[model samples]
Target: MSLHESVLCSTLPSQGTGTLTLHDLQTGTPLALFKHTSSSSRCVAVIPTRAGLGGVAIAAQVDKAVLNVYSFQKDQVLLKCVLPERLACTAVDKRGLLCAGGTAQGRIYLWEKLASGALCNVWDAHYRQVTTLAFSHDGDALVSGSDDAGISVWSVSRLLDGDAQNTPVPLLNFSDHTLPITDVVVGIGRFPSCRLVSASVDCSVKLWDFSTNTLLTTFLLPRPISHVVFDATERLIFAVANGPEGDIYQVNLLRRRDDHVEAVGGAGVNDIIRLGMENKNEQDPASGKISVGEEVTVLSLSLTSSLLLAGTVAGFVHVYDVHSHQRLRSISVGAKITNVYAMLRPPDLFGHTSLVAREGSIPVRPIAPLQRTRATEWEGKEVGVLLAPFGKETAESLINYPSDELQRDFALLLHTSPSNVREEPATATNARVAELEAEISHLRGQLGRAKGVNDAMWEAMVRKVVAQEKEKNNADEGRIKKKGKKDH
Candidate 1:
């Protein structure tokens, strides 16, 4: 049996009890729900188990700290475990062998899975309130970030291999950020060595070379980063920032530049309203305008890296096309979204399809570029006929499906094979080729600029290190002279 793509969202209660809801990401339908007896849930972590099974660990606040672990086979929960701890955050290793939880008081506890579906062998790891934790690709290392602005990389093997008498030390300690660290993720790419990335509340993101324990580069964003998810290729970072009017940015990892893609908050209400009016006449009275001061609180990226899901404080989940940056759909969940996790189906579940299948396919003559004309001229007019044989009722039926189903069909259409789509005119094909060439040229220039910046930063670091070494030598000479005078 193959697993299906799903999304797990933890809700923060506005006036009632909190709950964890799971939905099929492809269709946006509720799959399962687990009600929490507590008032609020803080963080969640997913652990991938054998035979395609998985488990979710949630930290909820009650009279005492509690960690609720739910084991799942596919879309249903199989088992649950309630542990004692006021965990601020949690992380699990790739193999689900190790689980780590960060506490509100800055302590880290590690747990090992047992055969009885329980987590055991708990141990302390961090001294300060840990904000985020992530396992390395190989599962041999664990990286943690804390409110103290310190990052520690621990040797998972050593930590697990040691006995109760011995404690393990961190392999590297990074303390460069001035503010609290919000998120930390281990990098995955075609790089020669291991890399780690950290986002801080100080409005900066730092990339580190784990092998050398050196900071590789830093990127400054417009606002403090609230959440971040890397693309499948790890070449792009999709991030949501903290503010009343939250904005989403696509940051090129290699070029180190931020591109504002979409505005999900109340600042873009006018644009959204205009779009709604253009799409429909006499908008539904029940669909009121998005209020001012709504903030996007959570973000998740689909496995294909083709869709982005953003959840707001106003109980709305907006999905956007990663390539076009267009809003695809907005869903109401009826509660503030505290966490959003996108789970991908196993590769065996679906046939292999090219992500850019339509890149060279049918560029059906751009609908005359949509000239600005009077609405009365086109209203209720059949300006064009469908190329394929389709009845009016069939077209209306396709359009009348629920929004989630329509969105799923749209995604499927994007993934259709190139051979299935109609071919474009020669003139249009040549124009598209030219556009691609220009884009490639622009990217090359950006790559060169990025390299130049990296080189300059490396030189500056060398100079600073040399100055420090010279100062240390002078101090040593002064101490030697003082010793000689004392001897005389």
Candidate 2:
């Protein structure tokens, strides 16, 4: 009972099927429709089952190597999961715990129990095609983005706990875009402190701090951005500009510019805010010449109606007004929009559809079973006698401290107290026993990067089912050698 109204999710990339819509930005309507769900370009994900209303998990869209989770207390699109790569994008974790995916061969799965579809870490984050993953409003870092122009970050508790002496790498990789990564966003701060903002098809955007990997700023825009949102007081960004008169820039991270006109990677140069699109006398902040056609892609941003949604490859979405640059409505959903999602849509996912559920809503929890299970293993018995005797007590003693006193002693060892308390507080039971010894060192680095992403995704689904059973026994020995050369 919280998460009241304001929706507009979307997704598209049609190759023959797609639809994940939710729209209703003050009367253009479309409230719910999951449709056949093929969606891949800008692969989807909604997640919110606890950051607001108490239900929603939507991953919506994907086919090769399946996937289809859609829950809001379920109706018809039961959960699906069958992966072995082929995902391409989807990141959740706004309080809905975790769920990520990005592949097409550049791994990064992480799932921390999405209803037991287990597996919680897998890496090899990018050499090509990861294209965006974000998650850091306290989901403990993770920031991806690839196609090879790079941008790493990770550290979801060092990927569930990595070991071999804490080897989980990537607390920032960056690479300074030589033209790939397209959108990132991430900062609503919290967790090693945030601030990311990416975007780049080379027309730059940069900005970073990703908890001290530091870069800070860069904007150089004009076109080639194709999707980038952040406004709801994250100090305005709202990009999009991709082609055929696409326009829609706006950068303003609150001014700061020694006259920016060129400043590649030594990052620093800001002030951009001029996103008033639709040919308002063609205001040229370097010829963005507003029009909203030929491409645009996607942009969301409605933090409870500061509205700025923008989607289009020519199927419309428009709606601006981020402080009166005005346009307020366009809607169209006719196809081409790749991912919009302005957020907060939990009326129990509009009650139901095609299978009925409405009445008082809230019930669905179905998830585990779209194939590829095999992850069990977590023995217990208090993990063999609540122990702690690991070789030589990790001797690396040589401290000088002061990374702000090690982030204030790691925010006072992750403080915790009022949990609807009536009695809990010996310093919240020693911060819940130091969060159960960091969940037993994230289940001992989840058996190593969550069993190396579920045993290399079941060893790539058993080598794609044994190469389709040796291509069906070499087409049955080439049709019995064409029937022994047609019986000679």
Candidate 3:
């Protein structure tokens, strides 16, 4: 039996069609989903304010021109704001301030929240279509990468332009990347202060030391990149790419004493369902004794990197030993898996929520564009679907099913499959990789100019743009209403 056979499964309402489902990983249940009502909800980010601060936020893009905000309670749509026409990307600060990008325009929108919990201001600070957005750990600033081949930083406090002698404050724009930036993430552990890592369509993941606003290192990917993320504790960085064939890779980033960089292949190129942190290995400093623990991918991993918890695209969430890459046990959500959202709950429980699995529909952006008629049919299927695997309840659900005996037999067979191991590629090729690294450097240098503007000036420009757009939308609505009245 395969791993799928041993796991129990259940279906969630194919959530709202076209929505991104974020499950509470700690409880192993669906928490909230950010759905695209008109266009598409590209990304969903949940930033938890300090514990007991009583605020957690979720932000998602809608129609490429608007971002919707929902509190953790999943109640009340907190904010809705229009942005540039084509919002290709979005990200949020720890305090729930939002940053978003547009295509062709290379502009980044900086959204701030008022003390009264309302959206305070919006600014257009970039000169090109922004592709990726990241925020400092402290939420004091935001980082934006654009197709214009530049990464720009905006100070959140600078929203109050008068503080700097009543002069308009300019955003710190860093011009790099010959190609469009695909993804950006703040540093996890050792490189903590305002450090960030960004991956580009140029097939490179570059680390930036924000304190200096300069590139620290550039790492290569096996193919054109798709998405990138950091491990729970930030000890590891993972990137995925689209290949001619169906292949994916999970690589680890490491720094060498010679100032050279290496992209060690830590996980193999199978269609990676989800990349997350697992298993934290803690060691005693005095005796150098190592304590091995469960390999669970939790929202936060331990200092030793021994415990990790992550859900998969296969509808199963596993808590396993990272060193051994062994599945301690797995829970299968009945639906094909999408994304996993992990949360921490009570003392013994850790939530591992799985998103709607990717099946039937192809990823929105394929490397090679197919003709309209040749695209996969996504019309009939329900959207926003997810599977949540319960712990004992999952086991019991299977055991009590009408076909309990068949389920038990299937479980036994899974216990016997060739171990269902996950393999990693070797890291032996560094020289040729470095040569390619040089090519990547050349690309980053060949990008165009990215202009910066004063925060106040940009804010005023955006407010005017938003007001005009709102009026146009209202006028269109009025015309539609008049037509309906006439027909009636």
Best candidate according to TM-score: 1
For model 1, residues 88-193, the per-residue Cα lDDT tens digits are 7777776655667677677666665432222333445556678888888778787888888889888777776655555667888988888888888787632226
Q: In angstroms, how far off is 241's CA in candidate 3?
A: 1.8
Give the TM-score of each candidate: 0.60, 0.30, 0.48
Candidate ranking under TM-score, highest first, comes to: 1, 3, 2
lDDT of 2 by residue, 143-242 (tens): 8888788888877877866642333688668786688887888767686665778888877777777556766666666556867777645676767767
Candidate 3 lDDT tens digits, 349-444: 112121112222111110111011111333462322223344423211321224444455444333433333332324535666888999988776
Instruction: State the C-alpha lDDT per candidate.
Output: 0.61, 0.64, 0.45
**127 in model 2: Cα distance from truth in Å?**
26
Clashes per candidate, residues 3 or more apart or on different chains: 2, 0, 40
Error of 2 at 17 (Å): 37
How do the candidates rank by lDDT, highest first? 2, 1, 3
- Candidate 2: give the clashing pairs: none
Which regions of candidate 2 deviate over 4 angstroms? 1-27, 30-55, 58-90, 93-111, 117-151, 155-161, 164-167, 175-247, 250-286, 289-298, 301-353, 356-363, 367-377, 380-488
